[model samples]
Target: MISAPHKSSGKTLVSLGVMYNLVQEGFSVNSFKKGPDYIDPMWHRLVTGSQCRNLDPFLMGAGNCLDSFISNSDEKSFSLIEGNHGLHDGMDVDGADSSAGLAELLETPVVLVVDSQKMNRGAAAIVKGMQSMPPKACIKGVILNRLQGARQEEKQRSAIERFCGVPVLGAIPKDDALAITERQLGLTTIDETADAETIIRNVGEKIASCCDLQAIRSLFSQAPPLKTSQVKAERKAIASVSIGVFMDPAFCFYYPENLEALAKNGAELVFINALEDASLPDVDGLYLGGGFPESFLRELSGNRSLLRDVREAARSGIPLYAECGGLIYLCSAAHYEGETYPLANVFPFEMGFQNKPVGHGYLDMKSVCDSPWFAKGERIRAHEFHYSKPFDSSEIDAYQFEVLRGFGVTGKRDGVLRGNLFASFAHLHAVANPGWARRFVALASDYKVKGRCAV
Candidate 1:
């Protein structure tokens, strides 16, 4: 496990570097992120050439987290779990759902990445505290990042090893070139960053030269064998349905498990580029995942034909599911920086961008009305992170979900329903909600059988 005292401590860069280096050395690396994130996994996938799965205990539960880790890490030469935020930071006061807790559950040895910019022996104190804290992770090694000179590195390394009683595996020098650009969401997506590969290669080379790969591999070997279920559930066969997925730079925030679940339930995924595609494809259902549609406002708004096609599909009883950015795309228009960009207009509402996050973090919602996707009174555990909200509040009561926790479309409700279309700001994961893919596939199959009848 690669973790740190806090966020922005250069652990992500270290993870990417270590993974890339190992992959280059002919080791198959399986990566997992410890939260509901789509961006970091993109970089991980780019480096390892495999899907980076998420292991969120709060959203997916501890049992699911263990099962997922065991299943995905099986038969792989190397398994790396990257922690989010601080090792002990979590929604729970007891830190039961933090990355340290996850490390303890999996019995994985953690490599602490400490930012040694303004401190010398203080880095050791932080490491010792993290090691001694309740729900203590098996912190076996430490990596001093962003060091200035040999004197600074010597001071930190000696202090950490002497006090924390852990090996100083690496002391990475401070280099701005190794950093990935941050945005309102987080790191820039691999699709939009043209030099993403170059950055990964550079960071990997730097890590290979500085870090002790042999020691890192030794720690990985110390993890105890996890007891995983050998039995795989048999999937019931269903009529295959093509589901169009918006997968371009404008819409790329899809969880890998979500797509895999859809395929397992017999749905053929057809990728669609919302920014470039002139028209919709011949698919039974359309999936629009979360992404930065706000970034390409002019281009998306200028794509008049595609917008009209999407609106037609929604009106024609075609099963359409959209999250966050997808919800924005399906709206009438978006107001940003005093400019209005026309969108699909599936629902008669306009979206407006805010300086701060309008809806962020975990969400608990109960279905108020029956929709093609979710049943009435169904409880949903999902998450939302967005800066955009509906400009017009007249459609507040038209939603399907009664928000119990976190902000939704409004402070009260979310999950706007129109015909067979369901749009929301909350993003769902298939591992947590096993019925999501099944129900979505069933909905699409029903639509396919009934044909495109106008609602």
Candidate 2:
């Protein structure tokens, strides 16, 4: 496990570098990221050439987290898990849901990445504090990042080893070339970055030159063998149904498990490039996940044919679902940077952006009314992070979800229901909401059989 004392401590970049280096060494590395994040996992996927699964203790529970880790780690040469935020940071006061807790649960030793930008001796103090903290993760080694010179490196390395009793595996000099660019939503998607592979390759080369590969690889041996659980596939409801997914630069925030679950529950996913595709494919249902749609306003707005096709599909009562960025694209118009652009116009409200997040954090919501996707009175544990909101907040009164915690569209309700369309700012995970995939496929099947107005 790769972790740090706090966020922005170079843990993510270090984790990616380690994965890249290991993959270059002819090892089939399976990587996992803690918490609900799409950006970091995308970088991991790019480096390892495999889908990086998320292990969120808050959403998936401890049992399911174990199951997912074991199921995905089969027949792999190595497995690397990246921690989010600080090692001991979490919503729980006892630190039960922190990355350290996850390390303990998986029985994996953590490699701490300390940013040595300011002080040398202070780095060891932070390490000592983390080592003695409750739910202390078994930190086997430390990597000093953003170092200045040999004097600073020697001091930090000696202090950490002597005081904290942990090996200093590496000391990386401060280099701006290794930094990844960021936007409002975190690191920009790999699709949007033209030199993404080049960046990963450079990072891998640098880390390989600095870090001790042998010592780091030995940490994998320290982890006890996890008890494997039997992963049973959900029973297929229908033979098959086609589900169109927007998967371009504009709308690429999708969980791998969600796509896998859809396929497992008798849905053949038809991936569509919203920016390039002229029109929608022949599919029973459509899914639009969260992404940076605001960045491609002109390009998306210029695609009139595709926009009309999507608007027509909504009007015809096709089972369409959209999340944060998807919700933005479905709006009649979007105002960003003093410019307005037309979109699919599935809904009547105008979308507007803000300097800060309108709703950011784990979301707790209950179904207020029955929709094609959810039943009334059913509770859902999901998450939402969005900077955009509708201009007419009153339109959210007819939404499906009653917000129990965290801000929703109207600060009270979410899950906008119109015809057979269910759009929301909340992003659902298949593992947390196990019935989502089956229900989506079943709805699509019903629509296929009953034609327009099937819901």
Candidate 3:
């Protein structure tokens, strides 16, 4: 397992670089993400040319972690598990539920990615504490990132090795070329980023030069043999349906597993851009994932043609599903910075930016209304992270459909679902709730077959 002291220490780049170099060296490598991140795994998949699965112990349980890891290992000789946030960062008191805890549970060896630019000997202290803390947390080696130069790199490397008693597996130089463009959600999705292949190759070259690729590969060989199973249950034939997926840079938050699940359950996906595209694709359903739509509110709002097209489609009974940024886009108006912009207006609501109402963390959703997304009384676990809040309570009340877990937007209420539109602030991973994609596809299938919305 690879972990960092904090976010943006080049963990993903280092992991992907190492994986790509290994694949180039003639090794069939598999990759797994530690938490609910969908963006990093896209780079992993691009580098390794394999489907990367997420292993969140909190959401999917410890058993599913091992299951997901083992199942994806069927076609590869080695597996790389990239962790999220900091090493010991988690949602529990005392950091007991952190990624380090999960590493201990899985008995996996961790390589610490330390940002060596700011600290000389202090970096060593952090590494030593991580290595010595709870000996059960098997931190094997350290990778010194953001090295200034040869002299600075040598000083930091020697300091870490001498003080921390851990081998410096790598020392990555400060290279602006290796930096990936990022917005609110995370790194720009591979699909939207230009020259993706060149970027990956450049990153891989830098990582290979700095890191001990051979040592990293050796660690993967130490992973215990994984077990596997197969279910022969026949897949139900889903009626023909097409789903319009928001794919522009502003709204590109989606789990690959989610899209795969929808396809596997028999729904064709049509990609559309919210920034440049003028109309939604001809489809039975529309899916608007999450991204930094607020930053592009002016551009999105100015695209009157696209906004009108989406509103018309929703009115025509097209099943529309949106999350976070997507939810904001469907609102009647969105207030950002100091200006207000008219949105799709599919839902009778307006959103305003707020400093105190920033929503974050895991959520449990309970369905209050029978909608195409979920059956009445169904409970689903999802993550919610945003800074905007609904401004008009009366308007929100007109379309409110689901309630959250005893918080924000009281008893039996959170998401806004009206007619064929299901919009929510919470973002979901299909693996967390395997039934979501199927239900979405089923609804779309119903609309396609009958020429009318399912709900």
Top-scoring candidate (lDDT): 1
Q: Give per-residue CA lDDT, model 2, range 1-455, as digits (tens).
A: 99999988888888888888888788899999998899999999999899999999888888889989887886556999999999999878888789999998999999999989989787899999999997879999999999999999999999999999999998999999899998877788898899999998888888889999889988998898776557764555454799999998889889899998898889999999989999899999999999999989999999999999999888888899899999999999999999999999888899999899999988889998887788999999888999888999666447889999978787888899987798999998898888888889988998899888622
**True-structure lDDT of candidate 2:** 0.89
Question: What is the clash count of model 1?
Answer: 0
lDDT of 2 at 92: 86
Determine the backbone clash count of candidate 3. 2
Expressed as tens digits, the lDDT of each residue in 99-180 for candidate 1 is: 9989988899999999999998888999999999979899999999999999999988899999989999998999998999
lDDT winner, 1 or 2:
1
Model with the higher TM-score, candidate 2 or 3: 2
lDDT of 1: 0.91
lDDT agreement with native, every candidate: 0.91, 0.89, 0.78
The C-alpha TM-scores of every prediction are 0.97, 0.97, 0.85
- Which regions of candidate 2 deviate over 4 angstroms? 233-239
